[model samples]
Target chain A: MIQLNISDIQHFSVGDGPGIRTTVFLKGCNLRCPWCHNPETVSRDTVTLTYPKANKSVTYGRSMTVDEIVTEVMEDADFYRQSGGGVTLSGGEPLLQAEAVAKLSQALQGHGISVLLDTAGCVPWCRFEAVLPSVDTVFFDWKTSDPTIMRERIGGDLPLIKSNLARLLRTDKGIHVRIPLIPGVNTSEEALTAIAADLRETGAKTVALLPFHRLAVGKYEAMGIPYPYRDTPPLPADTLRRAAEILSPSFTVYAEK
Target chain B: MGCIENFITGMQPPWSDGRFDTPRFLEYVFNDGKGYFHPSAGLNTGTAESITSMEILMERLETQLRAGVKEYVESFNRINVLPDPENYTAPFLSLFCKDCIGRGLDINMGGAVYPSVHGAALMGVGTMCDSLAAVEQVVFTHKDATIAELVTALKENFVGYEDLRSKLLAAPKYGNNNDFADKYAVWFVDFLSEEFMKYKTPDGGGYYTAMAANVSNIYAGHVIGATPDGRRASEPLSDAASPTYGRDTRGATATVLSITKPDYTKVACGTVINQKYSPSMFEDGRRDKLRALIRVYFQKGGQEMQINATSTEVLKDAMDHPEKYPDLVVRVSGFSAIYVTLAREVQMDILARTQQE
Candidate 1:
């Protein structure tokens, strides 16, 4: 009776994968990416978002057994099979609960469902090893190549993330390196070059350039938290193109608008 | 022909005079015509005659349709003289009617006079001709169940086969953000819209197509036999471009994603997407979520959306106790309707709409 601490199960998550997917946003992240979109899921504790304007409050972080979660996700099993889509396990950092994810993925695979794991890859190698067998695809996040930026700004270990990515690439699985081109942070030429060098060493085939957006500003306000990037507008199209130009030669670059 | 003639004659004063006056009535084919496209409308039903035969039939139908309009206009002109000063009730309003004309026809489409047929025939509006639930549940879903058994159950309206109806109810449905069923819906809109775009109205007014049938879907469903979508014979089809009742298991976001997949720009007349959300979704900052949902949908090329904020509880109450909620207005497709005024089954259908949280 393994229970998973999850924030929300987002059904029909189109932007997260190739086809229609159910994104299980697991609670609690290992890294503290300052520009994190889902701030509520950053903590393992049950977080409540109160909207003073709407006079509404929603409490996230629930403990559900693997069987219950699987049963809930299986409702769309027919959809997954028909559309070449399936479930995606994302998080605060799903690798933190690698053992639980392994069980979840095994159950989903038993039903012949595809599993996509979206992670920031700041965890140990054993976590990836434990979950990689059952997972079908991995959306590995690469925020910055600068060790100081990774440590001080996002609370991530650059060496550890790179090591995890390199090892994950060794496995014969669908791996997509996702780079969130944060403004004034990872958008510089030096940072992009370092990021490309790490991916090239790992033999990465595909890279998705996700430009920064202020979509989570409202959510931050609702949760009674001040967003540092509240005034920060979306990344310009030119910057996205520039980043794509830098990475396109090494890998298949897809600029996500 | 007689209807068109009467319509024109009734507006003699308004048409002939340099005045503008509202006619008591103006009934034309597109306004009230309820029929399918001409079989020669080029859908390639796959069982039709050779391409040559189809072309010949298409030419003949086009001639007849155009002639029908031409004859009506000629007869109206023959009987009444326009641009006359005497018939003018109001000079300003009458000025616009100088070029005004209307036409109607009973263009038959091989007895498949469904809304989708008219859309395709007149403007190539794509339609979900197939039901995913029907295919998933009745036709071939159950491992041991055969099509014969499903057909038998459907013919009997599942009266004696409660188990089969339950099974059918459990099948995959559209509007769930799942591509399996949504892909069909997407293709239906795209194909019909593209097909309809290849043609135009006789007067070249840009034949617009619509998926919104208003409350007429209830009546239309009444005449339709048991469909593959697990609908019983004469049971109301899904209301106004919406997925069947209680079939869309996913939330509103998924529904929007699935519905918006169809390219509605081709749907010049527009497509209607009806969704019911809990009133709370409209409150406070939560309304922004709904707003964002709509913005995303529109950005994705959705033509139109009609939202209802009535809770299922209130709708059910209105159905049971109509006197309590007389003024309860529900957006029925593109128009508003009193919830209590709708039929019980229709009310049931509205109640069954997934009220997104």
Candidate 2:
């Protein structure tokens, strides 16, 4: 009986993950990454008239019933057959709505469609395990390796994200690691190399490089939240190329626009 | 360079002799809306019925021409010709007519070009400044084509001479961002606007302008028949094929291009403006750019344009995630197509090009 809040669904999408995909943008997330382009994904409630005046950056989806979510999942059934594409659950964090994701994914798999879940690695293992059984692939965003650094940006226990990631890998669930290249925040060569080495250990072969962009800065104004990292410029292209080259030895690098 | 200028001026190359000699027909076309055959007479796509009030503008142009308005046409090229070695045509005009002209604005001057399969096709225009070297390459340097022979080739569709056709097509056309392309683009636009103002539509609509000339006429073959220009009947339409050419020229050296605005105007009687977005205007981003572009277009003498901005995101989701947003519409290349029915590549391409502007 759990519900889902989804902002938008995209089919024939190539940028979100490997292969063509129908990316389902879930409505909420538990994190508050200052640089998140989709700041709308940072909450759970679809519409809240009033609450304690908190950061407007936090927004989630309207709750939709499982049948409704499944109806959305089956929209791209034809796309999956031709492009080898599948559905990818993305959001503030699909894990926050793991029950809805599992329900929808299981429904899709029943009809022979492949499913993928893209998350910020902030949900519980029970949720992850629950959805993993039905989903075909998972892209776990590993923003920062440093616990305190991660905690400063994303709410929730860092230990929980690390453990959930490890669990997915230990179980050999379809999982890929993703890193956003921020200029000063995570550009240390050591940071790249360290994450690469850990991902190499996890049997996860690839890491997608999502370069930080200034496009979402305006969205922050609409949400009425002071951008936490105004001085952090986007990573210069060459620096990221170098980081990719540096990490190339340990983990397969996938660059996206 | 020496003779192709005639074709450039829209004279059929001599190669085509007795094609449709619509002198009276063409004269009527140039008369604008006042002419008996004016498309707007009964069509009435919200355009003015007459331009009698603009006699002053015509007199000024005539005086300027007679006084030798030596102003430089701020263009990368003037009268670009996409090489149709095969003498075949492309479907660009027909497509524009059938697809882009949904509401029937009566301004889309479809090319004389027909469709071709052998050669590559081109589209897109170069940005323009003012330059002479650019003008020479665009207007002058070309194979010496007799109006008769060119018309014959155009009319005959390059039937017997595959070699000549191949050699002709081998001539490089322009596109992408570059100096030559840009220069030719400016000159070509100015020339057309200048020339078009000389004659009104049969109904006497005002002169048309605002042509986003393709750096080269890759799609020229779409209308490739011999034109009244003495060329064959079915020749390709150049990107410079818009009705107005030089109307945007501010001085002898600089050009001012404008986007059309939504408000009704008397000048848009016979012009075409290039539209780039769709949801807000039928494009997802918004209509500010469209409004701006159209405003500029109207300011610079544009008579026609197209739009599709139905927010591809809405459409993309309906297709990829139908449950996300169940009902959304998108403007396809020419017509409105359901968002969910579009190919993913098409959807992504639309998204990639979507703008906040």
Candidate 3:
């Protein structure tokens, strides 16, 4: 009877996780990062996006029981088994509906499918505890090291987020600390050093630096909202390499384009 | 266009009591006596109403196999003994000159080093497998319709059976690496090749089964009736050995896995597994992924694959204004052709091939 608000389920998602995974974008996020690519998933309510040029309209946000989600994700179980991929629960924040996510993850795990959770870790530690029992891997996002920027700009509690990430790192589960390399937000030498110092304290070993892209401009256009970073060009390859160099001394770095 | 049932019935020789003169029958059907006739093996299996019942399908296939073997033997026997070789022209006679000088016989008179091994092009492996899977799933597994109802539905060309046709279309298809459907394809190649291998040419050459059907699929589809795979009466029948166009919703990897399930060693005449990709897949960085995919396919015993790298947008534009892109060449089955020179239906068929991303 438990239903989770869903945004979209993307199959053959190679970039989300290790192999050919199906990323289940759960509707609703607590954080408001300005450069967030998935703007439509920020709100819990259903929203429709219409693109005039493509003559296509898409509606996001639906309520589906865990059984329905399990059945749909299980359709690609063979692909997952073949390519070492499974389901990736990503979202505004996947831990928002902790109980439902726990149930969905448990059901998927029962079918021998690996479940990975991609979260910003802004929620309370209890939410992570609720879903971690069934999740095989955790892609914990660490946005910025500055407390004021985390609070005012991104609407995240730095202390709470850092504590949750540290606790997740303590567990035996696989943890991949992802840093979205927003140019003005977190790509500075000072900011990279600070973020790496904080991550080192949290005992994180591997960090994936995701370069910022303007691909979400169309999403903003469809949603009828002006993207703040529309005029900003993507982070150049050299800048991404510099950021990776700054973090290499603290943790193993992978600069993902 | 007449259906195969009507064609077969009309091909019954008047002099004989319900017995077909296989040579004359093939001559009238394929070549009109101008060229040779290679029996299209398993082309009509999916369109036959007996596909709803496996017992009847097996029986029909057995009868067709016997008739096809007879035609092969008769054609080879007749070609082996030509009374006079002097009537042929110089260019035609020159091909057998070495044989005539060395063995004092013409090529057709068994003087050539190798006997003529006829190539029986097995058309519509995808169509046959999809149709069988649809029947097994809809009729046997789901019990959504009975064999009698399905036969009637096909007889009516699914006019009032849209719901049934949708169910059939929604069933598990062949190109998704699902064993439920791919097993039928495996059996199809094994059974047909094993049976054809038992027969030999007059001078002892084995029959080679080919999955390459040039542009003949369009013509073959014209004669087939509504198939259980939800294909209408006159739609092109699943070009070459590839799946029904647009049915492979899964990406390229699953398609490669599904197609390589059949043993290609038994198919000495080669297969044409057509795959299309966006032009970007042929670019510098992504081209390596495509190369790796083909490497895996060949490593898994795939005999041959044909890839088209033109984007659908360009193809659509070419269709709209043929003069704009005269040099757009594309691989069609076992051969390549100038895109604008092909018929519109063939163009549409090429455009319908699922572009793997």
Candidate 4:
């Protein structure tokens, strides 16, 4: 009867994972990524986002038991079976509530549904161990490679994240090391190569370069906070391709739009 | 004003056998209240009866075209080409219609202000399109079965040919935005409109096509045999102009895209596209998406769309416990009715509509 702070459950989410997945965004993140798209989930307290133009308000962060979460996500089991898609436990770093996630994943797996975990890999290794048994795939996000930027700018512990990624790479689960290609943060050749080296050291074989987009401007506006990257243009397609090129020599890279 | 009002008041026809004494000739000629000349009867191209009726209509059109438009119009005035009687609730003028009654003329006999245009309500656009696409792909392209085998299966209502029926069912169906199947729908509207346009009504009114079957699709489906699209005999033929129920697996966007492929300008009597969505989609923020979708559908030349926001779970529950949901309203085709009051088959038909997420 463990309860998890849930933000929102999005069904038929094609971009979250393979097939038609339902993404469960857990509330509260340990790290503060300024350009985070889902800024509403970064806080542990229940937050309401009001949109003036849309004349609507959406409140996130509800306490739902593992059984309730399972029942809700199970509604799309037929779609999952047809599309090879299942449930994706996303963040606010799902590893922050590893125990509830473990229970929910186990319940979904018991129903013959696959479970995927999308994490920033900034939490303790013990948190990863709690959910590792039920998760079929791990989408580990590797942001900037510099320790100073990771610690000061992004508010993440670089060594801890690297250790977690290295350990996750050793597991039998499907691992996808994803890099958010932010323009000033990680688009430079030096930054890309450094990330490539870090991932290579972790024994990662394949990487997906996700281009930075400004789709979160509205989310920030709804939260009544000015996004730091609001004025910044999206990463050009050529920039993503170049990042892919820099990482290609070390590993098989996928340039995602 | 008083004289006109008095004339209107005096125009009520005498009651005979608990019915207005309207023209029995027109009713007898058009086979009123019977399935003999139902507008949908000739539209199900899968049946031999439909083919024979279509041939007769085509031959008549050929003779009229050979005689030329001027002569055809003159001849139409002399001999009334019977419009589908279902278009009028009363075969003659209404009991209180002053002009037609004063002129001693039925409404269809050049009595009204405008000439009567014929609306050949093509019963099942989705069924016809799906059947054609399935026949093309399964029989001709894939060579999985011969025409003889398919006809035999259809004749037997797919009793022993479950495998072949499965192949037909698996073919690209209409309303998926897949042009392989959608092109046939486009052709259905265009070809029928062109043919109907070739002939004029009795009073020189143009012939128009309609996809608005209303509830008559249920009745029309009762007579239709097994279709090439793997529809069982006597099953409801894809409500109105919408895709076959449960066959539009793709979401609402693709459904709208496929439905809008047909040039609706030709469908002067209009078409009805029924779509169902969960109740959450009708909320304020999410409702904008539905509005955007509908706007795009209209921009792409879609005629009409009827959306039902009741979720399948609630609908099923209402069916099980009708007394609890006495006021639950649902859109059945182009109209709305209380959920518990609708016949079980109609409720089942509404439930069968794919709920686009």
Task: Give the C-alpha lDDT of model 2.
Answer: 0.47
iRMS of each prediction: 8.7, 20.1, 4.5, 10.1
Using Cα atoms, each model's DockQ against the true complex is 0.07, 0.02, 0.14, 0.04
For residues B123-160, what per-residue lDDT tens digits would candidate 2 score against the true structure?
Answer: 22221121122222322355344323433453455676
Q: Provide the TM-score of chain A alone for each candidate, in the order shown.
A: 0.98, 0.85, 0.99, 0.98
Pitting candidate 2 against candidate 3, the one with the higher TM-score is 3
State how far residue B21 of model 1 sits from its true place (Å). Answer: 34
Residue A115, candidate 1: how far off, in angstroms? 0.1
Whose DockQ is greatest here?
3
Off by over 4 Å in 1: B1-357
Candidate 4: C-alpha lDDT:
0.74
Candidate 4 has a DockQ of 0.04
Q: What is the lDDT of residue B108 in candidate 2?
A: 25
User: In candidate 3, which residue pairs get closer than 3 Å at backbone N, Cα or C atoms, i.e. clash?
Assistant: none
Q: Give lDDT tens digits, candidate 3, residues B13-38.
A: 11100111112121112122221222
lDDT of each residue in A26-66, candidate 4, tens digit only: 99998888889999999999999998886568899999999
Write candidate 3's Cα lDDT for A4-73 as tens digits: 9999987656678776677899999999999999999999999899999865688999999999899777
Error of 1 at A159 (Å): 0.9
RMSD to native, candidate 4: 19.9
